[model samples]
Target: MKLDFNLKLTQEQRLVMTQQMQLSVKMLQMSGFELQEYIGKEVEENPVLDAEYDTNSNLKEKNNEIDYKKFIEYLNFDNYSGKNYYRNEEETVSPFTFISNKKSLKDYLNEQIIEVNEGEYTKEICKYIVENLDNRGYLDNTVENICEEIEAKKDDVEYALKVVQSLEPDGIACGDLKECLKIQLNKKGIKDENLFGLIDDCLELLANNKLGEISKKLKIKKSEVQRYVDFIRTLEPKPARGFYTGENVKYIAPDAYIRKIDGEYHIIMNDDILPKLKISPLYKNIVSSENNDNDNDTADYVKKKINNAMFLIKSIQHRKSTIYRVLEQIIDLQRDYFDYGKEYLKPMTLKEISYRIDMHESTVSRAIRDKYIYTNKGIVKIKDLFTVGISSQAYGDDISTIKIKNKIKECIESEDKKKPLSDQKICDILKKEDMNISRRTVAKYREELGIKSSSKRKRF
Candidate 1:
């Protein structure tokens, strides 16, 4: 075989994202509070970017044109009122940031330990027990192990265990789920032998609804076992459910609001709380200078910064406008929902809104990403406007999946506790209401709402 070397020339057109375009896309996805934080960093890095405060209503319900430059002085601090950073003076700390005075789980237990009026050695043992509690309010160490560690007798350790377990929250310092249930039961003065036996030896059977086995073994009626299980459902496994989670509480500010003016609905951007961004006159003057063209690097550096600043300003404007238009379209489509209640919420999708507004679906997605708007129904995320719908043989738009799920939750909440409604029964109930959905979908929606099935929901 003969081999020949040849080179072929081919050309193709392709679209590439530039640095400015990338920044614009990134800014488009940032929320209102996140944009403020990003702008703060940008002000520190770029000398050409300047900010000002706009003395207007942070929440405006009027229809007015958004003048981004109206912001002259940025008074963005909300939680730190007494702190002085703009002027040279003493730094006044905020009381909300003082975490030392707050009581932790261990601190709370120790206070109760001191009130016990027990012996010094016993109190010390209880203190050790309290300190050894895990974040879930469970004692990870056994009494025997604690006794060996402190060189104390087993009786003292057992007493300390009981003392620590007697603290509030009903189940603190408990070693396991069984002990936790017993402690909470003790607090409620519940001493049913059937309930105690269920916790100790038949928890698995109880969960699977084999109460017949429990009734036979414990010599208690099946109805009584069912009643005990129902009570157990009310107790929490993790006693410290709402303790300090070591995370700052995030505060959200809606980016836009829907207002009614003389029986008209309008979508307006929330630009008052945001810091106003504009190019510095000093750098602008330098960039527009024609005579000082001797140095290329300096001119290039200034021009690059100027272009970046302008693109950033334009990107922010685009973000606000895009969000405003999205809210406008959503309000148009789901008008009945906003005017009435969630029951009127229709089936909607990003594709539908994007097609109506002549925008790419991804663009619409980015515009509503982590964005919120204030309606008469209070503040709601823009993403919630896009919901899956279930079509039925009825008038009006398709019923939203959110509405269906909410209805399922209502059915379960109001159902007879002795014989809870099954998924098929719930489907029939919805059919009577003109809602056509399958039993599998009902079960799926039930699970999404954090609800168990009829068997698990059964009570006596």
Candidate 2:
């Protein structure tokens, strides 16, 4: 063996960082709302930077004419105190306050439990249980385990568990599916031995809507089994009642709006959220007029401040134009998806769009990060349309992985429940439909769609 200590490099590439480069990337990832907050903070910190808002500024100055009307319509008119509007209409008006008032699942449950009849020890145990519940409202720890940890008697824990179960959110405080179902059934006054046995013994099959097997095992008719199943289906699976408080409602303010006008899709950037920023003419004249004075230090200081202000304004303009260009390209590429739906979304990659738009792949990726587009359909995240492609069998054409997953879902929905399709069978079915996917690919797509295997999906 030969050992060499000398090293040589043929060629190398390196990235150099600058203030502008760092700011560009940071600005790209921020949404419209986040960017507004960031700009406000920057203005407060940097004396050289200033932001001014004018309600009378024409929105059409930045956006195209067609989109200007649609954007204004979305804004909607509201009457102020001076306007001669009806008093009853005041209740329907929405203010610009963006604060959210929402309580989490556990917090809501705890509040209710505190008001219930229970001893001090039992209430403490119940509080512990509520704190340990999973997001889906299932108790993560067993009662026995909790009793052992707390050094409390099993009866005390059991009493607390019962009280917790009786709280408003139906199936909470239970450890597993069996306990959840038993609590729900007990609340509904269902005490039939056959119904309890069916639930405890064959809940797996029961959940799959397999009425026949449950009927034969319990010596009951299929109609009776279905009636119970119908009742069970009405029960809420997630017992965390406060989970859907709408606290984390994500309001999307799109960067652009694309509309169909005269058989052509017109793209317009939404600059309503963006305040028109420019160097104050009065301030600029002050600096320029004092440049020839004897005080060199003052002149230099003014020049530096004016330059910083100009740079800040220019950055805002560049950011807006870059976002607008990127949105236009996305609208052009996803024209079919906007007209139709997700099914028509063609497979697109960052590199493809980057090349088309004469920007780097990283730049394009940053441009679309957290950005949104308002279309005729609704507000859609700009990044949601891109997906990896899988090749088809005939003519070797490629289809999107998302499309293949949708097809798999459709096949499962329409498949006969008596004989659920296996992974290989699903692959064959997809092959016939021109999606040349393998069994592994089928399993991957199935798992991604949250569909279980044939055995798990079987209807008994």
Candidate 3:
């Protein structure tokens, strides 16, 4: 009944993202390493764009006919906030200088295999087993499955499995956690039958710290069971934990550094990680020359490239400025944390920082996304500074979720081993301290801290 199409002109306000604007947002969200790569790609693609890898290098005059001062003024490199953004007297070392080759786990095993006096057939099977081993160094396939897949005898496969397991990283190629623990214990010359029994049958009980159940099952005294369990706890759960598992480790490069000097904290932007952006003089001349109207194609091309280069440079500056402002505000807000330590870190939110800096909450989020900052203690993710507030009932103040998690960790750490504190008990303790949190919330925070339940944390 109302199927009429008509053109209506109504005025409304809406935010439309242009290409440059989208690029600005992307730049803001990029980590320090990511921004470096993005800028590198841009330098390769855009003829008008040039990048100086040396941060300490001064601007050299190129193409004598062009005005160097005017060109420098046009690029605004001198006034850019990203250049020597922090005026700290002490020189900071670059983290990238220490990058070296990392030996993978498989490579380490293969190297040890070369020294073994085994026949080629057995060695081939050993290699196959090594290849099949998961990142945790556990042999995923059974001997029967290996025999079926490789068309080898079960005996040969078992022998090969033994050979692979005997290599360095003592617990390698184990079928399960129990086998792994036994191999490590046997290698360490621990020949206690009770320990072997505990590994075989009481692993679940051991995990829950149920020494009494273990003692009852093994017909041993509770104190003796506790001693054995304590020794067994030192075993490596994952054999491949410290070795490279063929995955490239992505290193975090801090965008800025917060250091304490004299009596005040200072923010030092990491300008070395990024290459300095500059307009190529050749392209600049082409864009600046006025008498080239006859060749509209080349002029338009150069002008477009110049516009793109300028926009890219502007976006980078905006990204740096936004991140700097956000970090500056964080330094101000979390001054106590920097002055003292993590225990003094105040609860902060993106909305609070956004209001303080007169920017939208989303902008603040993007500004800190995938960004990291080096502090006096260590490198920390910028987002980690912003934690959701948990209201304190006693003083009517808010506590950071991070603080609650820390408190939970402390409670579990200092708890009596014989009678561990339950989640409800922890909640009650926190409540007594004026932190109003439910038992469920306590459990959630405990889990987030990678802690086990009270039953699992308990000892004999």
Candidate 4:
């Protein structure tokens, strides 16, 4: 082989985002409070910029009158579909989760394991073992490895593990998926050696639904293997399912206000949080005097500062105008959502909005992202207005994903716990309504809506 070198030329189109444009986009994306904090810093650092506080006089007490519980029940449609939710008159504040308070599986398991009346030293070793369990409650370290780590005997570790595995949820501590299921099944008085062998020996085969091969290997009937599979399915694979890594709530300050006044909806940009900005008269005088006296260097410096201050003010105004225009378009398009609720929200996209407003898609994205608008429903993120569309066969139009997800959630909510609806059945129901979609697509949408599979949702 020989080395060779050649020069090549190619032509391509590329879009370059400039610093000022990037700053403009950044300003567009920030919430009212966030923008205020950011601008405060800029005003302090720049000598030519100053602000006049207390700009908003139209602020009203109506912002405080939102029914928090009814709002929650509306948002959590999965739990409260067609169910009347009432707020407690005794409570004064919103019940939204503002902090992460849920106990992790590791911590929850450790608390129970330590109460087993085991020796203090040995329990300490057990604590180490519990700490090593992953989010799925599967032991990440082997018994031998944990024993070595804690400088304890292998028997002590094994006994500790047994104590933990005996706890609630039936399968708290295990080394693998097979062990977890077997432990739970054993607790149920299930003594099938073939079933245990199937879990330990061919777990992968079971997962892929290869019942014929397992039946032949265990010398059991195919239906018998399937029956065992169903039993195994009942056992929890993820012991830490309900307990999560915890979540916190976010507080939003809307940058725009939209509401109907005398049967006409009005859109107003929020100028309260952001201070009223202007160029400092003192700095402008300095620039003018320096230029008149022919002090070239000082004049240039002052002029440069004044120009920067002027540009920032203009950029900020431009960002506000663009956002207001975008919200106007959103209100015009998703008027149904405002008039009704989330269910009436029409399908839309940043690209579609960009085309309609004759702006770049990226600009439209930045203008709406992380920004909120105040309406009758309280504060909502502007980005939530844009949703992808699914085609409708009956109306020959595109239906919003929000609408489909809501329907799927409502269907699941109304389902009988003993006879849950399958994805295929859900698809058939949709088709009868002339909204044709595939079973797999239905399954995908169901998962997106956080609805579990029919088998998992079945009640005893």
lDDT (0 to 1) per candidate: 0.80, 0.76, 0.84, 0.77
Task: State the weakest 10-residue window (summed lDDT) of model 2.
Answer: 84-93
Which candidate ranks first by TM-score, i.e. highest? Answer: 3
- Ordered by TM-score, highest first, the candidates read 3, 1, 2, 4
Worst 10 residues of 4 by lDDT: 86-95
lDDT score of residue 214 within candidate 3: 90
**1-460 per-residue lDDT for model 1 (tens digits):** 9999999999999989987788888889988878888988988898888988575553333467554433222232221124643421111233466767556777777888889868888889988997788888999888888878989899878987887788787899998989998999999998877688889999888787777787898888888887777788899888877776445756567787677778779876778658888888987777778866687677788788888788888988898888878887888888888888788888888899889889999989999999887776667888887889877767555788988898899999999987899999999999998889889989999998999889877765
State, as a TM-score between 0 and 1, how close model 4 is to the true structure.
Answer: 0.62
lDDT of 3 by residue, 105-182 (tens): 888999888789999999999989998989899998889998999999989999988899888898999989999999
For every candidate in turn, the CA RMSD to the true structure comes to 7.7, 7.4, 7.5, 8.2
Q: How do all the candidates rank in terms of lDDT, highest first?
A: 3, 1, 4, 2
For all predicted structures, in order, the TM-scores are 0.81, 0.71, 0.83, 0.62
What residue pairs are clashing in model 4? Answer: none
Highest lDDT model number: 3
* Candidate 4 C-alpha lDDT tens digits along 1-460: 9998989999999989888777877887776767788888988888788888972243223466756666665345322334644432212234474365667676677778668888887678767877787878788888888878778888888888887788776787788887888888888898978878988887887766666778888898877887788878878998878875545534466687786879777997767667888988887788767355667777778788787778778878988889888887888898889999998888899988898889999889888878887777666878888888778777677888787887788889999976799998998888887767789988999887777788656553
Worst 10-residue lDDT window for candidate 1 reads 71-80
| Alpha carbon lDDT at 448, candidate 1 | 88
The superposed Cα distance between candidate 1 and the true structure at residue 66, in angstroms, equals 26
Give candidate 4 misplaced runs (Cα > 4 Å).
1-18, 29-102, 167-170, 186-234, 244-316, 341-352, 370-460
Clashes of each: 5, 0, 0, 0
Q: Candidate 3: which stretches are off by over 4 Å? A: 1-11, 55-101, 142-152, 188-194, 209-224, 390-397
Following a full C-alpha superposition, what root-mean-square deviation does model 1 have from the true structure? 7.7
- Count steric clashes of candidate 3: 0
